[model samples]
Target chain A: MSGNFIVGQYIPGTSPLHKLDPRTKLIMVFAYTIGLFFLPTWLPVLLAGIPLGIAVYASRLPWRYLLLGLRPLWILLVITFLLHLLGGSSTAPPAPEDVWATLGPWTITGTGAATGFTTVLRLAWLFSAASLLTLTTSPMMVTHGLERLLGPLKRWRFPAHELAMMTSIALRFIPTLQEEMDKIIKAQAARGSSWRYGSWTRRAQALVALMVPLLLSALRRADDLAVAMEARGYQGGEGRTAHHPLQMTRIDRWLLIITALAGITIILWRWA
Target chain B: MNGMLTLRDVHFAYADGTPALQGVSLDIPRGGKTAIVGANGAGKSTLFLTLNGTLRPSQGEIKLDGRLMTYGRRDLEQWRRQVGLVFQDPDVQLFSASVEQDISFGPLNMGLTEDEVRRRVEEALIATGTEPLRNRPVHALSYGQKKRVSIAGVYAMQPDVMVLDEPLAWLDPAGQQEILALLAQLHRAGTTLVMAVHQMDVVADWADMVIVLQAGQVIYQGAPQGVLAQQERLLSVGLTPPWPVQVFHDLRLAGLPLEGEPPLTRAALTEQIVRAWPKK
Candidate 1:
């Protein structure tokens, strides 16, 4: 199985960002997201975009991967932009005599346009920051970071172990599922199931036919996983110890402090 | 002497009323390599499952080390640990996130100490020659490697007898030889082996005993030579003799002097053919 293809696919490199501890990357990502949300003006948006762009470049990942990650949310971006353009009239008019032109002869106005542009910029910043984090850090590292961050919660009866297990499994199988999908598609194609000449509903039904086998195979894989886990002596997440320990280095600490300061600065500027 | 494994008049049908196995009876002595040969849908896999207590027979009893096994859930769990079953599909057998964890699964379920489990994991990896693949993800290994890992997973449990279902299926010639050699080595080391296979060559050359299943019934069970000698009986069930046996039969038809039955291995066949040839 081509097990390396999935969302959050880490590009292995020797970049400084890649060397940072996973905990640092996790905290930085959270800080960067919060800062993006609080940025009130285009100035902050442009400035925030700088670190994200540098991070992406330094990680040496293809730019198209970042764009691909946003493909699913493209419709949402467009919807928000259109809504902001139409909803501006409820607040204030830009001009009285030229109101119709400013509002685009219907409901779109100057305020709506501004809001739409800001919303798009904010969405871009959030996605870019997230993509950078994923590209820079391996999934195992991310899971390790999560385990560390959630370690204290274990005292409160929280399922830190189970949650970490789920994360690792998701990381492990997402690529497997994709590879299965590709194989199923190839099999269907071999059987003369073509999507090219089908009606809209027919195409949808064909997709359903394709998905049934994939889902059934996934269920079988899950059963095998349960059996394998049981055979290995995994007894419900108790008394298991990790082989690799998580340690935070000096670069990790510095990165965490810088990201935290950036977050505070964004919040203060927004409130002021 | 008590047999290590015994099945008496075992009958099984699927939920949909498909009769998979009917009145199957066999006794597997400890520390011998036994091969079960049959066509697809001939109940070989069903028989393997019965050994491990995965599928209980409708009628008949399965006993391991003279102890009869019941179909109850508690008993089934205990019986399963005593018999390791390596499934035909490596993909199904290996579902762990990592190879080491997969191998340690059975030992852990048996409640071995952590250190013991680790030691067994290391030993199993070495036994299967997959020690370097310990850290590799289960899904990342090749099909042959995955098969070895699956075998290692079962081996780690330290079962007295190992049941393999079509161990050579989908493997290349080199892989087949490697696995066949490994099975022979295990048998020599006194690990009982019960393998289901379709390859007559392997059954003739490697198995100490051959059991032929046709339409879910064992028609013949004995040494490989006696089974091969029943040409018409084997032909009735859509089975052919091994290549050497077929060649021997042809040589006999050509009026060659032969003292006894033809051999199964290449070296034996060549030696017999040279001996039969007229002195020049």
Candidate 2:
């Protein structure tokens, strides 16, 4: 159950990608995502996976775990792929040789297969790139990078520091809250509250019971955390120095330049 | 008496008008271990809050090193910097994902330079013996490790006095000893240590001064030796005398000959009994 929630799961390492500035990775992933939309054909989509593949390799993340993390998303990816496979474009008819298979009123064509395969590949690349960012960078570093990126917006009255702090805190408590919930569930189960074998309405009722305690505990925790924060001299994030301050190193700079060049090249190719 | 922190006639009430602290006055000795013991409804936690400037006393005042504490924004920040508070539950205090980052929060909020914050974080991690867990996520840690990281968070601020609310609560015996050792280390380094604890044995073994609270008022405040000798007074306040004290009292009541005051700690009791044993 816990393995599926992989977005914020960080694996500690000293690989070059792990050592890169989080801001660099953030920007690279952002540009890569936008470039992914510009790639028109299956060939360009496959081409786009090259940099992502290199990133995954550089991250030194265990391939088994990385692949396992994508298990939950396979359902969505398969659904999208199947939709495109069965629902071919209405405007153009494929060459007779392009006909692949026919099932009850639905015809599978080469173009449909290409579109489905390309769409799945694009989505996989997007997921992998995003996952790689989190896998290498700690949540604190990500928050630090985000705060630095949003520093300029402070002039416009943006509460960037507070937002980052909140993000970091939320990330910290995710597992704690989860553990609390697990305990509550086991406690409830011991009290003869069947969570697994309930009717739809019964399940809803049981969930309400579970949710009330979770929400109440969360609120209590929030109150205690606020007190703790205040006792530690937290005052609105003003004048606070970051322990892991974000600074772009030479490698970070090179990575940024390479990502920008790749993005522009993809845009030019799509335009041409 | 003058000490690191002096609270005079401090009274505090919740927003709902329930009094948590009522006319509480005490002094926490400088560079000394002061333990506050009380029942569940007693205001030990409330008093710690007032000490750290988290809750302003409704009526009376608190002084730190001969200076009256102020509630102004800047003053409160400075006050909190000088007096760090570690809550009983590490989950509440550990707000950062990583141990190092959590420890860094206090020093960072002090507006120190990045290098200085890093130094302080490293020092705190080493002090609490949580250096290896610095990069680990807070939730991944065991309860005892989380407890140490929480202490490390407050220690990074390098407060003149550290106040802990039930620092040993819910810990195993070995973990409690480890924390007590950590506290002793901090004290040896010149930081005043004040804690509200329930373990009577810990209070007797560790605290130089013991303050017993009943219904938000101080029932007794003095040396642990003097306080632990009065078993009835402690029991009335919902606190039992330390085990050795109880045994010492029982021995005297059973018509056994024992000299001097009752031993406040196990080692003292054992030594006294050994000395009183019949000759071979």
lDDT of each: 0.79, 0.87
lDDT of 1 at A101: 50
Docking class of 1: acceptable
Q: How far is candidate 1 from the true structure (C-alpha RMSD, Å)?
A: 4.7
| DockQ of predictions, in order shown | 0.26, 0.75
Top TM-score: which candidate number? Answer: 2
Q: What are the runs in model 2 whose C-alpha is more than 4 Å off? A: A1-8, A91-102, A269-272, B257-261, B266-280
Scored by lDDT, model 2 comes in at: 0.87
Report the C-alpha displacement of residue B86, candidate 1, in angstroms: 2.0
User: Ten consecutive residues with minimal summed lDDT in candidate 1 chain B?
Assistant: B71-80
Clashing pairs in 2: none
- Candidates in order, TM-scores: namely 0.78, 0.92
Q: Model 1 lDDT vs. the true structure? A: 0.79
TM-score of chain B of 2: 0.96
Worst 10 residues of 2 chain A by lDDT: A1-10
Candidate 2 lDDT over residue span A167-230, tens digit each:
9888878878888999899999999885677798888888888999999999999999898899
